[model samples]
Target: MSLNRRVFLGTTAAASAAMAAPMVMADGHGKPRVVVIGGGAGGATAARYIAKDSKGEIDVTLIEPTRTYYTCFFSNLYLGGFKDMNDLGHSYGGLAASGVNVVHDWAVGVDRDAKTVSLAGGGSLGYDKLILSPGIDFVDGSVAGWDITSQNAMPHAYKAGSQTELLKAQLKAMPEGGTFAMVAPPNPYRCPPGPYERVSMVAHYLKNNNPTAKIIVADPKPKFSKMALFQEGWGDHYDGMIDWIGEEFGGGSVSVDPGAMTLTIDGEETAVDVCNVIPAMKAGHIAEIAGVTDGNWAPVNAVDMSSKADADIYVLGDASQQGDMPKSGFSANSQAKVCANAVRGALTGSKVFPAKFSNTCWSLIDTNDGVKVGATYEATDEKIAKVDGFISQTGETAEVRKATYEESEGWYAGITSDMFGAKT
Candidate 1:
């Protein structure tokens, strides 16, 4: 359903628990220790919730490599020039101030038996419970003839920091009336509406700066999240400027040559000024290293997001295949709260609430033109199934679209605050 101000306020209040210092456990050993292996939406929120709700009964340590976190959610707007680099960047100092022992380092390994996490810099942290939210890593050979080494030429701006800057620069440098091609990923990737939103942002930039430039999308999936809404927006705002070739129309047979800057869809090769290869992805490296992944993603109990393989560990964000979630930042944040509640209860005998989830994904088609699709979920035996949903329909008036855009702006502010604690 639509994410209104009331919902935003409620979500914010849930995460706004007052910070407290670490307290000793009943057995006099120490506080129940919880180590989080990633510092994005999932990991950070989990750490915050356990620390705050447990009232310092849980000692939380968040391990993230980056000092300054750049959000993947609003990154597309930066490429569209609606926002700048600083606008998308956040500091972990706020989380640190919230009593999370924020450790800046890579998590190299996980010893399930020992209940320890090895850091890239050496040494390990002991944990009674662990949260893994390492985000997505590209699947090797998912996109034909593309690998990590060739990323400079055909950048995947999925990570939202350096790659985003690279893609934006490449997009602006395209020749007048030149072609910009994107190789969209298959299903179950992070942010289902992400690739299309990127296309919209890129078009927003090109339409203003280089109106004659064309955009082409070669996708492996026949349909995508918010397909009808996105298609309708494309037709209304940029009818002739965008072309999408889904799998039924030769997208599955697509290949790319990074060196030559050429994309082949069904044996027809076209040279493009820029290529963004959004390859198929899986849970980050640490999930598999921890031996928690079933195959590609870490399977979790939908009730609490605990790893089905190991109860001591939990998986959140894009890394967990809990069912029916689109793997958006909002979804990860929602899951983190449920996870935090369960973790706190297990550690401190705190009150546990029934698990419920909600996610809203907002996309900007052009200036002040936005649409969204979202749902509320319930935990069932099979999966976390959708209870009810809503979407921004076509043929809406300009005022409604602008209001939708404003709602998204409010969400971005609310979620980031919910996620990182605060700016200062």
Candidate 2:
């Protein structure tokens, strides 16, 4: 996806909806109130899809702070200087247009016993079935000296929007020959391949604008998503511009001094001119407070994303533990469709047709040169498992690379269109 903001909101009608106040859905006759928390990739998609599929039987209420959402999927383009931040921001106007109630508020906590969600404001909202897709929250104590304030010193840029902009600005402001350090998180984090893809993008920028600059990855894991292909691409393409520190090479773990722009790994400290720290993550704050997360992520039944702890609640996105599925934007979008059908089934009190899902995540090695991984999945009684999956092979000819590039664009158009295309 391009980093041009225009793509997020395709029409002027969406912009006008952003200017309006919050829309509330009344539980007419006290129908099932499905309160969805967080309005990003998963929650927003679920709310819109469930509301449309249920045909007014389910009272859909979405709790989120922002009217506009910037996607993490394409924010790397912005960081790599290929696109602007505007290209990745999405608006909630489509949900409103589809008859889904979107409230601009932060969900502080969920009162599970009382069945109410406490908001930052003085109000409390109730729900019959709560769909929690609040995404990932940084795990404390994973990186020493890196708390909220320290975040500004070394932006993670994992969540996108302002943080992504900050990372880009810092990169632009760095000296021509400066080093860029990316501390990649351990496995089971949002966008498994994202950190590596990010370094590729950063290398692309440095190669063109600051050839003397270097991109270093401090990785916790020895292997990563499409590791072979990424490594080959980096070595053959960016080559010397990109350097990686695997688990055995003083790269796996991290300790950071944000003020110093320094990262310590394997008992040795390494200084960098710029840093992007992606810490460990769990379910978002709201999900944690609601007693949904077992440790870091919410445990859900694979068949429908229904929380194992709560009957009516369903978890999706990076927050939910879907066995064998990597947490990516495409995964969240696909999970939403599955959750939507489950919500409809529960509301109607009948068995629904089986659901199968597919996800494709495309990362740009450079502009016009992209790599992709895709999987088609089915749900068993216990967990979601991949039935088929493939990654783009390394050193494919230009023609094949071009075809995947176009395919990537086509997938983005189709997924976003199908996701946001639904009427409120």
TM-score of each: 0.94, 0.93
**Candidate 1, TM-score vs. the true structure?**
0.94
Q: Which stretches of candidate 1 lie over 4 Å from their true place?
A: 1-28
The lDDT per prediction is 0.88, 0.80
- The 10-residue segment of model 2 with minimum total lDDT is 12-21
Candidate 2 lDDT over 1-424, as tens digits, reads 3322244335423322433236454443577888999887788888978887788877888888986788788788787777776666667777777767888889898888878888887678788789999988898877666876777889988887889888888888889889888888887899987888899888888888888998878887878898988888888778788878888887866778887788787788878888898888888888888898898899998888899999888999899987878898889888888888888788867467686877778888876788888889999888888999988887798777777766766665555545554222
Q: Write the per-residue lDDT of candidate 1 for residues 1-424, one digit (tens) a residue.
A: 3344445445433222333223222232777899899888898888877877787777888899997889999899998889998998877767777778888889999999988888888778888998999999999999888998888899998998999999999998999999999999988899998999999999989999999999999999989988988898898888799999999999988889999899999999999999999999999999999999988999999999999999999999899998898899999999999999999999888899999999889999889999888999999887889999988898899999999998898887877777777664
lDDT of 2: 0.80
Top-scoring candidate (lDDT): 1
State candidate 2's TM-score: 0.93
Clashes of each: 0, 9
